[model samples]
Target: MPRIHFIAIGGNVMHQLAITLARKGYQITGSDDEIFEPALSNLQSAGLLPKELGWYPLKITSNLDAVVVGMHAREDNPELVQAKTLNIPIYSFPEFIFNESRNKLRVVIGGSHGKTTTTAMVMHVLQQQSFQFDYLVGAQLNGFEHSVQLTDVPVIVCEGDEYPASALDKRPKFHFLFPNIAVITGIAWDHINVFPTFEIYKAQFEIFISKIEPKGTLIYNAADDVLKALVKKQPRNDIQYIPYALPQHDVKEGITFITIERITVPLKIFGNHNLYNLHAAYWVCKTLGIDARSFLTNIQSFTGASKRLEVLLQTNDVTVFRDFAHAPSKVKATIEAVKQQYPLRHLTAVFELHTYSSLSTTFFKEYKGVFNMADSCAVFYAEHALAIKKMPPINEVLLKQCIAQPGLSVFHTKADLQNWILQQPKEYTNILLMSSGNFDGLDINELKNNFIHL
Candidate 1:
């Protein structure tokens, strides 16, 4: 059996990868300063959880075949330093995944948004048809036991993130995949801390396009003006371009039904963005030889990737949804979707400025009219987040003014935000809690229960 140790194994993908390798007969050991739920519980259940917290350089021995370094691990990490001294090979998560799937056909989905949902959609269709393929989706799907899987399958589908591979490797994670079939769902300005400027952020996708293998296929969204401009600006001769737009669909009493070949297919998912995602997924599956009718039949059951418009509670009068939407484009789309789905209901949208981009004053300017559809809009940010990100302290008064929405409320604490939500009249309304973080550790279930019991 191969021996591999993880420097930081408690991440969403990291934990799943650890368990994957363990199931593959590798001796997996890992350490982290702190491991939170889902990851903690998952690692514990897999019997791969570290007995002790914090780094232990002694764990990095010459006997280990490799050290898998996560983004959470710094260059100064003792285990990493010791591994270097021991001449043990170090592999970032993407690097390791690439090595594992080197012989397989890699279908990588890359974009600023919609990658996870699109990837999940493709996975759902493939699984429904019983197509045996390996995958590394960002979220947990209904039937999948793990988020990452390594098998002898000929194809590997991955939700390619644009974030840096690791501290040691500053290259974007998607850059390492060198995909055979690549999909760019739509590029929006994001990861300000990593890419800094919009031009620089957009350039990464261009590089990603260039990195696709010769004779590879590129499926992209033509609806995005920015992405379309980029694709046209940087023409690729070596690869094929296949563009997709939102499919023809109709909404009847809150259900979105797709029209294909004069047959109507009602979807569990709604919204223009999701419709775009469905189109992208359809193209990818079509490339893999799955017919249109089969794709439509299988996709109806895919509720969505976890946290992408996940409904925690739904009644005829009230519905509560949570989404991992911190970026301005995602926030705007999600709000519009809920309002469109439930047009008559009053929509209350609460968002968290959690990511570095969302917190930066320069980037936050793009969010000006994102919440216009919501009847009530509230923004919340943890004060300590500014210090942690080494950003200049924000002026709430100035920030509120920057938002420029009438009757907009800003929250500095979780308790105050909770109280505000509880105070709202809970009749004939839709509540959307949007954040990449936990809204400063606010218990959403408790909030949902309160609304239900009231």
Candidate 2:
């Protein structure tokens, strides 16, 4: 058995990948500065948790067969330096994934907004057909035990992240996959820290397109102007390009009907964005030669990815949704989706500025007008977030002004925000809490219970 050590393995993806590898019979050991819940417990249960909390150079021994570096570790980590000195093989998380699935047909899903949902949709269809394939998705789906799954299956479906692999690897994670079938859901400027300019960000997608294997397929979102332009400019002749758009749909009484092959299918998941995601999934499945009707049937039951506009509490007149939508484009799309679904209801969109981009003073201006559709808008930020990120304090007034929604409100503390939420009259109101992080450890279930009981 190969002995592998994970450096900074307590991250959401890193921890899950470590556990998956350990389950595959690889002897996995990992370390992190501060291991949090779920990850800590999961690693401990698997007996892969490090004996110590912090990094130690001595842990990088010659006995280890390979070292997997996680994004959580800095470039100058002492353990990383020690590994380099020992001339041990080091792999980024994506590099290792590519190495594992080299012999399989790799289907990589990329984009800014709907990659998770699209990937989940494809996986759902494949699972319904009883097709055996490995996968690594970002968000948790309904039937999957872990977000990252590895097997000896013939195909691997991955949610391709455009983010940097690790401190040592500046290349985007998706660039290394060399996919046989690739999907770009859409391109919206994100990760301001990595790609500061929109042009630089778009270039990464181009690189991803170039990485497709010869005679492979490039599935793209035709509705996105940026992606469309990129596809048109691709000089690769060996690749086949497939374009997808929102399927024909009608909404009545908060339910969506998708028209596939002249047959209207009722869908539990609604919204134009989701419809587009479904269409993208259809094309991917079709590329793999799955019947269209069967794919649609399987997708009808996929509620959604965890926290992607997931409803936490619902009553006859009030609904509370929690979403992982911190990026500006995602926030706008989510707000529009909820408002479009419940046209008669007054939407109260509340967002926590949690990401480095959302919290940065330089990038706050990009979030302007994202919440214009909301009847009432509130932006929340925590002081500790700024301190920990080592960023300068953002002025609440500045954030509100930049967002520029009339009557926009901003809060720095969770207590005041929670009180405000509780006081709102519950008639025909939709409450959307959007963030990538918990709002300073607010109990979402408790909030939901209080709303339902009231």
Candidate 3:
């Protein structure tokens, strides 16, 4: 078993990867300055928890087989510096993943949104078909035991993130994977902190297409004009370009039924965006040799990736959903899904401006009209979140004006937000709590329970 040390292992994917490698009997050691739950509890349980928080150069030694780097680790991170000085091989998590799967077939799912859902869909259908494969998905899925798997499996499915890989390796994570087959769900400008302009952001996807292995396939969303235009502009003679659209579907009695060939199968998941993701997954599975019938049969049982249109509570009177829809496109798509699913119900869309991109006034205007579908819109921002990101304070009046939604409410305090939510009309309503953050430690379960018996 090769010994690996992780720098900044407190990251969501990093800790999960460490735990996964440990389970496979590899010697895993990791360190981070600050660790948060789920990662903390998970590392503790695995007996790989750092004895002390923060970087220690001593952890990286000449004897170590390799040092795996996480996104948050800076170029000058002491452990990283130590590893370099000791002549130890260093790999970013994605780079390491590519190294492990070099001999295997790799499928990379890349896009501004729905990376997790699309990747999870591919994994779910492939597993149900009893095909041997490995995977790296962004979110927790119902059946998947871990976010990453590294083995001798002949195939691997990866969520190709556009975020910069690490401080030293500034390329997008997906660039390292060098996929044999790739999926680009769509393009929506995001991560304003990194790629400041939309064109700059779109350029990343262009580069991703260029990275596909020769004669490999590129499955993309033909419905996305920007993505389609970009994909079409890139003239790759060796690559097979397959475009997918939302498969014909019907929503009856609040249930979405997808039409596959002559068969119409009911789906646990909803939304046009989700349908788009499923279509991409379908093409991937088809490329891997799974028939349409088997793919549709397995996809019917996919509840969805965690926090994407996830239901917190459901009563005849009220339905509460918590989603990780912090971006403008995602927020709009999620709201559309809920309102369309429960058109008759009064929809209250509650959003938390949690990410640096969302909180920064630089891109705040992008969220305008995203909440238009909701009957009532509520926006929350925690002061601490702003402080942590070191962004200037956002003016609530300006935010409201920017969103331009009728009767939209903005709350800075969790208490005020909770009160606003609880005071909402309970009967025949759908409340969607959308954010990338957990409302700054807001008790979601308790909030959901409050509405259950009301």
**Top candidate (TM-score):** 3
Question: Over the stretch 1-454, how does candidate 3's per-residue lDDT look in tens digits?
Answer: 8999999999988999898889888899999999999899989999989999999998888879999998889878888888999999999899988988899999999999998999999999988999999889888888877788887779999999999888788789998898999999999999988889999999999999999999999999999999989987987999999999989999988899999777789999999999999999999999999999999999999999999988889898988888999999999999998888889999999999998789988687999889889999899999988888888888988888788888998999998999999999899999999998888888887897788758
Candidate 2 off by > 4 Å: none
Ranking by lDDT: 1, 3, 2
Residue lDDT tens for model 2, 1-454? 8889999999888999999988899988888899998889988998888888998999889999999999889988999999999999999999999999999999999998899999999999999999899999987788888889887888999999999989878889999999999999899888888999999999999999999999999988999998998998876889998888888999987888899887677898877888888998998899888987888788888889999889888898789999998889899999999999998899999999888888988788888989988998888888899899898888878887778889887888888888778877778999999999998887777778878888
Candidate 1 — what's its lDDT?
0.92
TM-score, candidate number 3: 0.97
| TM-score for predicted model 1 compared with the true structure | 0.96
Clashes of each: 0, 0, 0
Tens digit per residue, CA lDDT, model 1, 346-451: 9999999999988988876788889999999899999888888998877788777777778789998999999998877689999999999888899888888888
Tell me, by lDDT, which candidate is best.
1
Q: After superposition, how far is residue 167 of candidate 1 from its true place, in Å?
A: 1.5
TM-score per model over all chains: 0.96, 0.96, 0.97
Clashing pairs in 1: none
